[model samples]
Target chain A: MHMLLNTDQSLTQRSEHALKDSFLRQAVQFTTERLREKKEESTNALGDWELWRERGRQIRAHTIQYLDYYLDQFATNVEQAGGQVYFAKDGVEAAKIALEIAKEKRAKKVVKSKSMVTEEVEINTVFEKEGIACVETDLGEYIVQLAKQTPSHIIIPAIHQTREQIAQLFSAEQGKAVSTDTKALTAFARQKLREAFAQAEIGMTGCNFAIAESGSVVLFSNEGNIRMVTTLPKTQIVMMGMERMVPTWEDLEVMANLLPRSATGQKLTAYMSILTGPKRSDEKDGPEELHIIIVDNGRSKQLGDPKFQAILHCIRCGACLNVCPVYRQIGGHAYGSVYPGPIGAVLSPLLNPEDEQVQELADASSLCGACYDACPVQIPLHDMLVYLRERRVKTQGGIEKVAFRGYSAIFRHQATFQWMMKTLRHVQKWSVKDGSRWSSFLSRLPIVQGWVRSRRLPYSTQRSFREQWKMLQKELEEGVDNQ
Target chain B: MNREAFLLHLAKQLGRPEIRNPPKREQIGAPDHWKSFVLPRKSERVDRFCQEARTLGAEVHCFETQQQLQEGLQALLTSLKPQSILRWDHTECPAMIDSVLNRWKSRIVDPIADPSQALHADVGITTVDFAIADTGTLVLCSDEQKSRGVSLFPAHHIAIVDADQIRTRMGEVLAEFRGGKPPSAIHFITGPSRSSDIENDLSIGVHGPAVLHILVKV
Candidate 1:
């Protein structure tokens, strides 16, 4: 299995590769546009959207603030329902626990619905190494799995693949020619996955919202694969982030209102399954054994940190990705993390702060604040990105610190700043061509080369802003005298 | 790690030595104004439910009596010509519909029985617990008799709902679970199984029922 985290290449190199792929650029742009427009329309239909967002934020904040208590209550309820709960400190432990469960069941095949937490742990690779066939049942996840790629987007995993590409992947898997038609391709996947669903002994799913009061895991999906994954297999395993919980079903009502509207512009997705536990003794067709693995995986680090605590409020609706300009252009692969876009930029570093490669993802955003606006729960992702950048600079201590120090020294005094501006005017004159236009020499300069690569450096004026202000003042005084 | 240790570590990380009591909540659910949002009449709610259900790509039929409902089911079954039919074992559900279903091989799903029969059944019928008008959603709770598979595994799902069961919004239905013990599973189905995973192009019936028919009795 191919993991999406390719830290061997830096962010710049990965972005350059993504920029070269015109298909990826167009596909990402098209899908994000559609999703963004849908979110706008749906939110518009539900009037007073800001009020709704604030409610969402409040509910999430309240839940996270009391997460410890809620987690305890939730675990107790799950056990009461004849279910087992496992708390994993990290991804490695989570994967190990899942592997142990599989081994105990003697499972040969496991059908999985899409879950970002599983990807964070690289669970598929672990299961495959243990000789367990892990099949991704979600249509988009199945496509990417067949192509040996990781999900590019949160909601729509295979947003980067074109129909022709998917047809090729399916054809290769089936060992037969398949048409590029969406219906035909989906039909083939549906037929193939049905067999896998029946044959698999264990089913794995990601929890969207785990209600503490009822000890139920709520799932939102347009396709029915998640339902199948939970229903067909005898043993059901749920991989949930520790933060993915709500205090009660009432809170779930608010979340159910916001998530689907923000995600696909639907009043609700086609299916919203609230699985409380394994099948009742008298029930006909649900999993008999239910195991929920709650993973921290660096989430605990943000608990008391004021700047990033709000990040745990995220519902993983992918609204931030839809409005992110940087994400739309470069696509998800460039971020080089399990998550991509604004959330990824902030989360990748926070989740694995020690890794220098993941730390660099913080620099991928423009900090335009669109992500904050687009977020359903109003998580200030843009602000979190800036904080990550500051932390990185403080720890790494690079040329940026020296340059900023020198910049502060010059700007702290008026006379020194004026002197530096006067000197810069002379340097600008040397760099300008035809006494008016900016020349390539400015871009060639070592000091400004990095900034000029992706942007145009505006030509410096003959006079500084202070000098211009002085002349404007004199002109205003002369005009008053004439009057 | 075990549950107690994990919670303890989290409490320490959160800067509390022990689990802190839940803070006082000023507000709990949707905004104050939203709580009052509801249709005044049952007929209007049913009308809106049917309209929204059709918009989501599900077939809706309304009847004035049980006989009309049976006739409607008969016409639908005769037209679709499903190879097999699966019905839930519920007292509220019209048992006489079996006469119409007798044309095809039919069975009443026992909650304790093996569910393999649903995998091959072409049509599954169940009476909905509740219906939401705002989103045209059906709420189905799993029990010994009302198997989750009956509504899920078949290619086509036919849900029979009484007009009085229609509610105004999702919250109204969710509110019922606030202080009660929830069932093993509660499914809120809006439409037939659909996916836009393939390049954002919508495809129907990926893994569950492709066609959903909701029969509302007045």
Candidate 2:
């Protein structure tokens, strides 16, 4: 989603931009808080939740470890079931393959279900460039699509857009002012998308899990738009990450249990469709032609990485985003990627190791471990964050390296630490006093200005902690002598 | 791109040679203890399923006798007031339900027919193959006779299930599908289609049935 016009701006610059949008902050907070509370209740209700997380982790890890085999098995089975498979090493190729299919089928319109992989590949942009109308069928996705922006959250794509904003989008589409009532807005999307679904020549979806046993493509959704996308069209294309594999149907049960509870607090999403292949010879509905594009991109890079391989186990449930403190404060666009939040912090960097801007997303988390706990498969994102930070600094030397190095050298020696503190205290005098506190000027200083924008610099406290403690001890001695 | 190069790179990345056969799994499905959390009796399972369905915002009606079923079906059909009804030709459908359908103008969902028939129908009636109590899910396997459109597309859906067909957990039903020539589509529907996508406001019937009426025959 490199939607920043590919500018040379830093993460803080984009985050500062997001921070200026009070509506965006409130919208992000509102949704994350609601999702976090629901996740807490749902996971607790599931009982022995950690056991489920472990099982989920085991299945994902085992499948990822033997991914080449499962993928081979899955491909053979898909072919046996009368479906075709294509392999792409990266996003551009994947989008190219999908477009070729569209061109071959002479498809003029494609209705799409919500798929982060599709967003990552920018397939809609690919089709739009060719004058093919690709309509996003999911309600949140449709809203974001109308606004011409990428999804901000995985589950709730328009998590940063309020109802009024959505209403405005719909109104512009309708050529009339649409009310902000949820019912009216939903009705409009249903009516408009239904017509598109009925006429669409091709349907595109993202695979939630590809079963190696039966070669089934499983999709979970609450709005049922996925069903519409898969059913109403003549040909279907599925964008799949190479790692989205499970060995059998039984393992799907595990994912089915964990994903819904983690994402939206549903015991099961309203619709969990397992489509094995194109419709059987006698079947009425479902796509007649099915093509699955397995994209590797940089996923292969994580296959053997001991420190980063676990990231492949992520289900894209967005639970990590809900509990991430940094994601809550700044929202998804600040990460400037298709994925956002703690998982995004690690994944965006791992997915695009060469992009220095993407690498900075690794620092987006607070290292709170909340994301790890909230994760359905228990990816140790906090630990991975440290690992990414280490790799980043080692590979790409930056001003931050010098800053932290100086910080470490000074803090380890008392004399230098005291000297630095005294220097800060003296320099702090240049800072003008605000209503009740000093260091308002310090916040304007170059190195720490970003840090002090919303926070106080604490005035360096005039005396160090050790100095204050020594004076307190002498005062206690004097009091004892008096007694 | 060549598939061989793609998978080979993956194998190399995984630090192993290519694997030809499926590896034996150490763990499968849900944990052992979850299977033990089963209801003791059929009635208990039925009650649990009904309770779950109601909690999930579906209307559950239990019928102990043919008369009750007839009355319930009549009331549901009349209340919905559907001018056209689409149904699946489930071989296992009860004789009574067939006779009941005969009273109304209904036809089996014919694949060869125009799809717009199902698209325009206000109500769809289908017999669920399995009813899971643990999550109140209806498992519908689509085939030549059992169409997916019967359950989807309609604004209202009426699913009939035998109470004893209800299982304790989703895994139990899933375990049955281990090696069978499974249907092309197996839908696990927990509730009527819904979305909270618009500013997190829950809206039912966003592209699927708004009202899910479950008829459990005890």
Candidate 3:
């Protein structure tokens, strides 16, 4: 999910191209709108959606604040339940561990359900290099894998692909032409994937939540692919973020209610599977070996920082994405990361922290606070975006410093500020465009070259509101004197 | 790696464990007013739960005796509209559904032994131990008596539930598991297999049971 796209062009350049794509814009808009409507109805139907969201937030916030304890407890419990747990400091380490496991097991084919962390660590590519065949069992992941594209949506990975594209993918696999009809295409994929399920030597999954109390991993899936992955294969590997732990199964109940409803408006996902460990001495179907890898790729950085700590509370429900005006306009690819939308805007730069490269990503937000309102755990994403911008400027200490100093100097002396404004008014007349002042000057401003290149700014009015208000006040005083 | 080395590594990475204050669990699900919500009768409860499950495309049946259940299943298999039917090994107990199902001409066996055979299953029959009325979840405990594949591996799953085992809420059913030495696996199924993979357009039975039949016998 953290594949580094060559940042050859600036953020502005990439965003400009994304904004101009008519198809991408319409697709993102229409999809988010429908998703928003469904989310609203589903949450309302459950009643007290906000309360549920708050509960989800509280649990996440508490767990992350005490992450060290919960993670330790989770590891201890996993071991107690007859499962092995690994802690990975970063993506490279995580990938190394997984690859080593695959080698040890002599895995030929690995079947994986959709896992964002796996995407982040680039596990499939790692296994592929080692000559192990890794298959994505999730239908969306399979479609995108065939298309040779990264996932465009968090929940719906292949949302950007048309039905015809899917039909085409299936047709190639089937050695026959297939129709774009939903049923026809899905039936073909269903039949094709069953072979991969039975043949895979290892199965991998992403944990939705790891309950520490019972030492169990909880997975929520509509397709039941996770059930197949964990149950059918001889070995099961679950890659979980360190922040995914909840204290108990009772805590999991709250998350289960919030996540599915906010994510897809399902009263409940069709399947909620809780795996305690591998198949026991007498059990028949489950995997013989179980491993849970808890990863912390830049998550610990937010632990003590009060401003950004709430970011760790995210349930990864994608609710923020659906409500974001910026994301609905530019779509996911423009963010240039696996996570997209407001959550991505805040998270990507923080995780990567290559200041020279990611400063503009923080500026990509509109600061509308819609993401905060939609967030299941109420992560203050818009405020975090503002904080990131401030942090970027503070680190630079160039134009931003001089610009603020000059402004503060003028404000301290009202006479100087008035004179500067009057002088600018006179100078603006020469640069006026057609009757609107300052338009021509703004278009030519070197500092705003990127902004004006893509979008046109409104010209200043003939008279400032301050000037008009002053004139009206003078007239009122004159009438009062006459009376 | 052995569990001991794994635990030590995890402990080192986690650093010092923080002293956690007692958590303030929020008023979590269903509003305060709705906490006392209850449906009037078993029929009403089952009907409402079934309706919601059906909206997700699960099938439903109400039967009085094992013979009626078998007849319905026999018709389903004979049609072979789907081609195969997967059933749990214990579902074929001599005095139960098996006594009647033995008369049918379809392949009915424990799916775990030959799971690949479930690919073309016209119907999958398994007995659920309990039902949660709050969430419409059918709970299946996998052990020697039951195979998880009967509920999961097939195209269409016919889950048999006794009317007396229906509980009022998920908490009640969950409480049952906590009291006992729980089984190896506990699966909570609410509806038919479904996915909205293609741009939020839901496709039922994509990878699991397309049709889910819950039989509540009186």
Candidate 4:
């Protein structure tokens, strides 16, 4: 049931690999820091950020609460606008639908702007298997595709790659040596992707927000690749998550203000293309045939579950990722999902709670609440992590279960807890040395070996709190005669 | 699954077998206070727009009349020395500039007989639908007379905007769309095309116009 289209490495293994790559760790930290600072500055400049965040949350909640109504409205409007809408239950079906469209177009090549839903469905593999050349038009996506890797960051997909690596990737693609200069690298990609854009019969883009009122698909990009994807090809396909809908153009104004500032610290990206439908009969450019595939792909599972439904309210701004401390340290590869960071930690599991590997991703957070604070829509991801851990423990009983049960049994009885504490005090004398060091190195061997391996176990005080309280009370009773 | 089955399944999962009618939206757009926020004076907005647009790497020029706008365009064309120019077929654009632009191989992009001509042109100019002073954005709507490629495909884009058309915020521009069906395409161009994909280095003009100039007529 897991729809993650990345590698199968466990969270621990991926984190270990990421930790060893010093460059990746530094790059992730630096970029996340930059994004976080920009978000802070822009939000502060805008003023009333908390009020706007609340409005965004309210809008998302309302839309998702009655998603059926909005979605039906959106589909009908799209149809009236002369576009077709398809609903897919899972990744396989979504990819098959896209492939079917491509085949019907007799497409030999397809150019795509960056779309996380496409990655989730593994759509490129489907197209490639069908012998259609699928080209990633976004610069970051183009680099990652050349290296045959999934995106490591949401906004900046190639955040894990250094400039030197990108130069090599571009050189390999161009069959010539390319310099590490940013301008040179960008020019090369522009030239390379220009051909793809010109020759491709079908173009694909990910919808940032689908305006339910007008049936318009809004795309935000700094590079304008989306503009090319929507304008240059004859047939256009938009793949979107089922929850990526806003009610009206008025609501879109709120999202337009929030998403860019939270994502890249700009009032807006360089280009925000709002395509209502395919080309009108008199228009010279734009796609002639437009198809929008709304993919559920496990999104429906969150609808009724009260605890996890808020996960669908996310706007994919990556603000939570930038502020996540663990994500800063381990980078996106550690999550091992198309989405990475705090959102990924909660979303990957909720999307497929039955998969052991996906369930284990919940353990990748520190529960520091930074992500919750950073979230523009205010999804309490830290609480969701705890809930996931509780569910996991309930389903797979372990040593933690026995330990908690024993502790609860002792604590439920006052006398038993007191007796246990007294007994432990005597037993600690054998382990604790005279001056707080261990009496012998071997004395530290038994109970706390795992805990003390990386940290010092503090010596417990000889007198417990109850004993000290009793002695103080006796002293107070005798103090009247002495005075 | 078919669309009907899909909607039915979602409704069931949501625990509401029947689709709920749209709720009464109390707070549809921005907050009431934001809606009532006062816009700056026309001259002040124009000044602020120039500053903000420059901050985002776009050049801005202010003029008081069509004659000044024509003179400015002529000077810009002389300095840049572009090989060819493309202008949108909008009446807001001054007709006299066509003479200045005629020195080079120039064409109006109204009935775009060939799309590649605009794509290969050295410079493309269009009169914008509206300008946002706060974000320094220009809104362009595509129609029979306005080709989307005129603003997108060229190396340099010069947008002629009237001072009165500038609004204070993005919400103000979007509020206009509440009345009718949107056009085929509406693009909000903030600045020159840019990408920080290569190690977070900001490079301009990756896929679209490299330089964007806002020529404002007061």
Measured against the true structure, the TM-scores of the candidates, in listed sequence, are: 0.96, 0.92, 0.91, 0.95
Mind giving the per-residue lDDT tens digits that candidate 2 earns over A136-221?
99998999999998788888988788888889999999999989999899889988898899999999999999999889999998
lDDT of 3 at A202: 90
Worst 10 residues of 4 chain B by lDDT: B104-113
Model 3 - which docking category?
A: acceptable
| Model 4 Cα shift for residue A71 (angstroms) | 0.4
Q: Which ten residues in a row have the lowest lDDT in candidate 1 chain A?
A: A433-442
What TM-score does the A-chain of candidate 3 achieve? Answer: 0.93
Report lDDT (Cα) of residue A466, candidate 2.
Answer: 85
User: Model 1's DockQ?
Assistant: 0.78
Give the top-scoring candidate (lDDT): 1
Candidate 3 residue runs with Cα over 4 Å from true position: A412-416, A433-444, A453-473, B1-17, B20-41, B65-71, B78-84, B91-94, B179-182
* Proportion of native contacts present in model 1: 0.87
Ranking by lDDT: 1, 4, 2, 3
- TM-scores of chain A, one for each prediction: 0.96, 0.89, 0.93, 0.94
lDDT of 3 by residue, A388-443 (tens): 88888888778877888988899898789878776766665556533334656666
Query: Which tens-of-lDDT digit does each residue in A1-483 have in candidate 4?
Result: 445534557677788889999999999999999999999999999899999999999999988988888889999888888899999999889999999999999999999999988988889988999999999999999999999888889999999898999999889888899999999999898888888888999999999999998898999999989999999999999999999999988899889889999999988899999998898988778999999999998999999889999999999999999999899999988888878898998998887777776887788899999999998889999999999988887888687677779999999998999999888767766656332456346345654554565555555756888899999999998997689
| Native-referenced DockQ of model 3 | 0.44
User: Model 4's CAPRI class?
Assistant: medium
Model 3 Cα shift for residue A319 (angstroms): 1.3
